[model samples]
Target: MSLDTAALVTKLTEILGPSGIIAETAAMGAYLNEPRKRFHVPALAVVLPKSVAEVQALARFAFENGTPLIPQGGNTGLVGAQVPLKGNEVIVSLARLNGLREINADAGHMTVEAGMILEEAHKIAEAEGAMFPLWIASQGSARIGGVLSSNAGGVNVLAYGNARELCLGVEAVLADGRLYNGLNALKKDNTGYDLKDLLIGAEGTLGIITAATLKLFPLPAGYETAIVNLSSPEKALELFYAMRERAGTRLNAFELVPWIGLDIQTRHGMLDKDPTAGPSPWYALVEVSQPKGAEGGLLQAGLEAAFEANLIDNAVVAESLADRTRMWAFREQMSECQSREGASIKHDVSVPIAAIPRLIAEGSAAAQALVAGIRPVPFGHMGDGNIHFNFSPPVGADDKAFMAGAEPMHDAVYEVVLKLGGSVSAEHGIGQLKTELLKRVKDPVALEMMRAIKQALDPKDILNPGKMLS
Candidate 1:
């Protein structure tokens, strides 16, 4: 069943003009190389469709010829979802499909084509005096299609929610080249089935998302950001509870970072100055939003309560926008700072909010037992319970050897995560990287249902074959 590469290229060239196709292996480097650099398989060709009709034609050809199609966005995904699983598959990049379909800031919703860069969307919302609250480290390059497809949950999940929650509907091209027009700005709809939810977070297995109507919120007057010094994660959790109690819906972000993060950032000169008030074992980046025409100081009031309760001893509350930006820069640089340290084994996981402390404690201990002196840097959205549990190899340890032991490290962490009623893949969806793990840990009936839906939607298995359910 070998694919006729030459014939396939000819057909693709006909469907999309020469300008829209990248058949050369050298030219496909950007599409093949993912952020993690873990997946190296090359795609047959990279096809850039400018319109939804072009996407439909591409899907039709893929479906008719039994050729696998991997839909890609900004190529910023950590998991290998936006890249090729097999060398024979063709990558259908949505970069050219990016366009603003419609927008209504007053209605708190806007419809935009899938290829729209996330940062561009933010700009569009800001121009209308509205806000698209999904903020991620890669938002500068990540597109709406990949963001919604992966159901990205960034720092603001505490307030505005993730990509799926932020999106009202999506317009996608099905496997058979049929366009499923589900785009809408409706706040409430008694839909027969949540097709939007299914397509979203599906990692391109169910369909190729072309456009999405995203939910927007009124712009906040200001943000109160702070970095609180804490002795341990337990104290951070207590402080998070206090902040939430005080700010409620206004509490935008609650991120936890260990001392290692600051140390690495400082060592690498990633920060101009320390963002925390003073040295501590852990620091919590807390942010509360101030509504338009409302009195401020909710965060300061909450911090005062925390200080009175002895939950936190020292804290640095941002006095100006520069201070706030610096504080956020520290939190945003957590993942990048790890790369400077050394080879790191990372897990994007979530547990019951109450079980976060134990997850970190036991998970760190387990890793140390396996690799002596492994630096544990478990930090992330503490308010929502998703911790980017990561570890840097011991000082002077072999980077290759450290990565060789990644499997055992993953097993150890996932064991703890599952036992504590947590999801192994939290914000990052189950791309090719986690498909096998999903099979092992996912409930039997749930897996069956997922397979059934995938079968119904993609009967020929041409849409992102060997991903997610595979």
Candidate 2:
């Protein structure tokens, strides 16, 4: 009882009206094209649902018609989770669902519809004299549903945690079209099973997140920012410990960037000026939040102590807001600057904080051994133990040939990551890109439990088919 394309489009258009449904391939390009541009499978139709009722109706129709439905938010996901896999699936774009449901500035919470942009949420919070600390590079385009779906972690994860931690509760539409009304402002609940947590990082395989109640925080009075020059990752770690002891919860961010990153960025003319303290083997960008009624300079003080201890060779503390912004732009532009070089093999992995030095040192050596002259650029959240371990091909190397050898490069780095008791995919979840890798690396018992849950929840294997689980 498979419905033809015309019939399916007609039915969806009737349910959502003409403006809500798109069937032309050209019109559906935006939804199909993901951020990474790696996944290019075209979807059968793209459905723009304007309300929760519309989402439920679309879900119900797909459930009855056996049409695979891919839930898409801002299309900013790094992995291929928000794009089509089977090519015949329908994409349910949540862009029209944007709205600020409520905001309680004093209570430290805001309830927002899933389609709202992450940057918009920040502006709303800031207007109320509060802050939403999840600051990803994609925040300009990433939406709430996709952010919560991927459980995105950014620079401030060392302070506020990931999307899952910032969310108090969520409201999602189940595979069978039932709305799970779980949104709440409560700080404590003895509720059953914690279903909200289950759905937060499920990657839309279990349900479609419609809205979420997110926790807010008092706006910091100001920030103390610095870029310190270090000899190595080990020294960065030592400086990190000293800063943590000094600032404690106020230590907002600690990011590591290699010297080559600075070189590439400068060479590409991406930065108007250097954001670091001259040249060094490594640099750690640190920030400390100053609460209202508190003084700044905590970060500067910590850097001074690190310099006195000989943990850091040189440092530059941001003297103005522009300086701070430039420093952050340099750190956030790490991924974008790679494209200017050429083909890059990337892995988002994490080990324990104490083992970060070894992880970077050994991982770099292994990658160099595999591909001679491979520019190893291991950098990211050193405080959270996560690193965007990436390698740019040698100068004047073939981009296609270098990418073709990615599998061997991936294997080499992953083996080292495994030996260090780290995770293969840290912040980014196992999308279609890592389904097989997840199956192989994940524990057998854990895999069985996941499959059992998938079967119990989405019995028809229609919700985001061939994603997260095989």
TM-score of each: 0.99, 0.99
lDDT of 2 by residue, 1-470 (tens): 28998899989998899999889999888898887789988888898899999999888888888989888889988779889887889888899999999999999999999999999999999999999999999999999999999999999999999999999989999888999999999889996788888998888999999999999999999999999999999999999999999999999899999999999999999999998879999999999999999977788778888888999999999999999999999999999999999978999999999999999889989988988999999999998999999999999999999999999999999998999999999998888999999988999999999899889888887789999998
lDDT of 1 by residue, 1-470 (tens): 23499989988899999989999999999888899899999888999999899999999888888999999999988889889887889999999999998999998999999999999999999999999999999999999999998999999999888888999999999999999999988879995898999999999999999999999899999999999999999999899888888889999999999999999999999999888998899999999999999898888889988999999989999998899999999999999999998798999999999999999999999999999999999999998999999999999999999999999999999999999999999999888999999999999999999999999999999888898988
Alpha-carbon lDDT of model 1: 0.93
- In model 1, where do residues sit more than 4 Å from their true spots? 1-3
TM-score of model 1 relative to the true fold? 0.99
RMSD of each: 0.9, 0.8
- Extract clashing residue pairs from model 1: none
Residue 23, model 1: lDDT of 94
